[model samples]
Target: MTRTNASLIGFSAVALWSLLALFTVASAPVPPLQLSALTFAIGGVLGLVWLWVRGDLKALRAVPLKAYVFGTLGLFGYHFLYFTALRLAPPAEAGLICYMWPLLIVVFSGLLPGETLRKGHILGAMLAFLGAGLIVAGGLSGVSGAITGYAIAFVAALTWAGYSLGSRRMKAVPTAAVAVYCLATAILSGVAHLATEITVWPGSSLGWLAILGLGLGPVGLAFYTWDIGVKGGDIQLLGTASYAAPLLSTLVLVVAGLASASLSLALAAALITGGAVLAARAGRQA
Candidate 1:
């Protein structure tokens, strides 16, 4: 795809992902592990169908086992913890905290060969961290369990950051890799569900809609489009643009009555977006 189209796809992925917290929260009665397993299972099946349609199903075996291992761990680890945070805390707050991944990506990208860390990146990260701090502090005042949620959300962010960074180094086809990752995540989550939580499928139409939407949109198509965008488009611009997700996510949660938008949310958005813009500028100059 052309860079413009790729960029649009990338932005679309971010927009879709912004709804993930809302959907995951809506699917609450299902429990985190089971919900993850079901959603990813659906996504994995869709991905396989996509591969078969493209005549790329044969390519899965050619991918190194190491890629599958890391990809599975990364994708699974993030979503599992992310689901936990959404359950334990307000969706808006948890969503913002989890978005630390983009900032982490900007910083970690410098660790690659011949990549230089710039002042703007450092500055931006600090600002973003401060914004995250404000969010956490604000969240803590509202709920007793917010601390644990924030901590898990941060870990989720770190997992995703590592995933994105590691993804850039792999030569495997992105969609195929994501398919394997989703399948592996589903298996592990299923095992975890059996060991811990009761398996309860969504019974309500609203709950089922949320699960299907998450599986098809954010979990399935978004990953493929994101891989295409990051691999083919302006990485800096996409990275910067993704800062909008938290703001948009918070707005969605508020409008849906899942959470209230507060002053902390606005300030956090500004700081994080500012930092992301700065980091993007540094990348462009580099």
Candidate 2:
């Protein structure tokens, strides 16, 4: 794919995940654990099936156990914990909290070989973190749950950072192979989610449909594209495309009659986006 295409695909994945939130909230009565699990299971099964059809299931044998473990922690652990947080907290809160991954990635990237602290990266990190805080703090009109959910989401963001950092080490790995394993990790999380649920299948057709979207789009395709994007970090357009996710998510909300052109949210977005952009630039220049 061309750089533009790859960037588009990358950001689309982010939007797909964002769009799923509306479906999730519409069906919010379902347990987060179960929903998370179902999404992963479907995504993993599809990935594994594709791997098998392509005769690449054997590739799993060649993967280093350590790297696979890290992938699981990033892909699976992060998803499960984040979903759990959603159940404990509001989606809006969790969403903003989780974007901290970008900032965290900058911090983690600092530890990489030849990765000297850049002023842009430092500044960007501070900006993003501060903006994330404002978005969360400013929009706390009807927050639910204790600080624990927030805490879990925070840890989930760090785990995503860990995943991002570890993903940098897995360069040259086949994109499909990496995606399959990550989906496999997600399936494990889903099984754990189902463990406590009262039923095995989705309660309604809508629920099942959401599961399908969760698997095919967000859990499966999105991650695959993200993995591809991470591998092609040399592409500047990928950064530009990354902005599309929030915008896409916002679009999803608008389409669903969920979010609107609110001065407050716009302001919050400005703070978070501006802050994150500035901090990222500063960190890079550092």
Candidate 3:
């Protein structure tokens, strides 16, 4: 694929992945942990099949052992933490805060050779984080779970930055292979659920379909594409561009009545939009 096409595909995956929170919020009876465990269980199989069809099977074979291990660290650490955060806080709060991955990557990329901070990085990251902080500090403060949920979600963002950095080294592997290996880590989490408690969900056709979408869109395809996007561009730009997903999510929630089309959401839209633009410009300059 051309680089521009690859970047678009990658961004689309992030947009699809953003819908996860909205679906979880709508899936009233489903426990977050149980849903997440099941989603990943199913998503991994789907990932393998997808790679096979795409002629990416060689990717699975070429990946390094260390890449596989580090991939697992990122995959499991991120999904598990993010879902656990949902159990504690409201989706909007966790989401907005977790969107700080760009800012975190600005810090993480400093550790990478040939990547360093610039004026745009400092200004854009500060604008993004301050905006995200305002979001977490908004009208939702009455919910005690919000604090814990946002904290867990923030950890998820940090871990994902780790994953992105680790992934940058796996040049021998296809992005597809790394995604499947990362996804397979969720089996441990799924097994923990099965060994401890029954995880069957009461569902009609539509409910099951939603779960399937979660597996396909967010877990399998979306993650695979994100790895592609991160590889295509600078890690910080990819992270910042990802903030756009939540802007899409905010619109969805407004339509669903879970959120108001209020000033806070608009402010978030501006900050995130501006940050992504700045990051992209910085990438071009570099």
Candidate 4:
């Protein structure tokens, strides 16, 4: 496929991710690790079905164990931290903080071999960080748990940014490999949940549907499309487009009555989105 097509495929992940906070919130009371296990297992099954349908099941054998290790760590680490953050803090605040991955991706991409760190990238990062700081500062006044969640969300952002940039280095890896990653993540999450978390199944059908939605959309196909995008498409452009995720995610929460609309969140969203735009412009100029 052309770079344009690949990038568009990647963009679809962002659209899917817009519903992440909503689904996560809707799948409530199920502990983070347990939720991760269930959703990722569903996601893994979806990937397996996809590979079987495409006659690419054999591709898994050619993949390096190290690649599996890397993918598992990336997928598991990001989602585990993200789910925990949302569980501990307000979904909107935690989600916005986690969305820093897009800005981080743009900034971190500068460290790649052919990319340069322009002034605008730095400026944009600073602006976006200020927005994050605003959230952190606000969290401090709320409760200790909120502050902890925000911190975890920040780290989750870093984890995903590093993972996305690293994916570019593994361009030779097939997209089908993400299936293995999902299954591995599910296994890891399952072990962790069994060890630490009490099993709390979704209490209602709506909760089950939310978990299914996450598995099918954000956690499932999003990873595959993202792999294709980062490896074959314009990474910087995708990073810029990713800013939409936070805005859309926050809006979804608000519209769903899971979160309240606040002036602070509105301002932070603007800052974060604007900074990403500035960073993208700088990348293009370079």
Residue-wise lDDT of candidate 4 within 1-286, one digit each (tens)? 9977988899899889889879988899898898888888998999899889989899999999999999999999998898789888887678768878877887788778777878887777667666655543444445445788989999999999989999988988898999999999999999999998899988999999999999999888899999999988768768766766766776787888876788877787887677767776886788
Tens digit per residue, CA lDDT, model 2, 119-189: 65556556545544554455467767658888998999888777766676687566666555656675686
Candidate 3 regions with alpha-carbon error over 4 angstroms: 1-3, 86-97, 134-137, 142-154, 195-198
Worst 10 residues of 4 by lDDT: 135-144
Per-residue lDDT, model 3, residue 4, is: 69
Q: Against the true structure, what is each candidate's TM-score?
A: 0.82, 0.78, 0.85, 0.85
The 10-residue segment with the lowest total lDDT in model 3: 136-145
Instruction: Give the candidate number with the greatest lDDT.
Output: 4
Q: Which residue pairs collide in model 3, if any?
A: none
Which window of 10 residues has the lowest lDDT sum in candidate 1?
A: 135-144
TM-score, prediction 1: 0.82
Pairs that clash in candidate 4: none
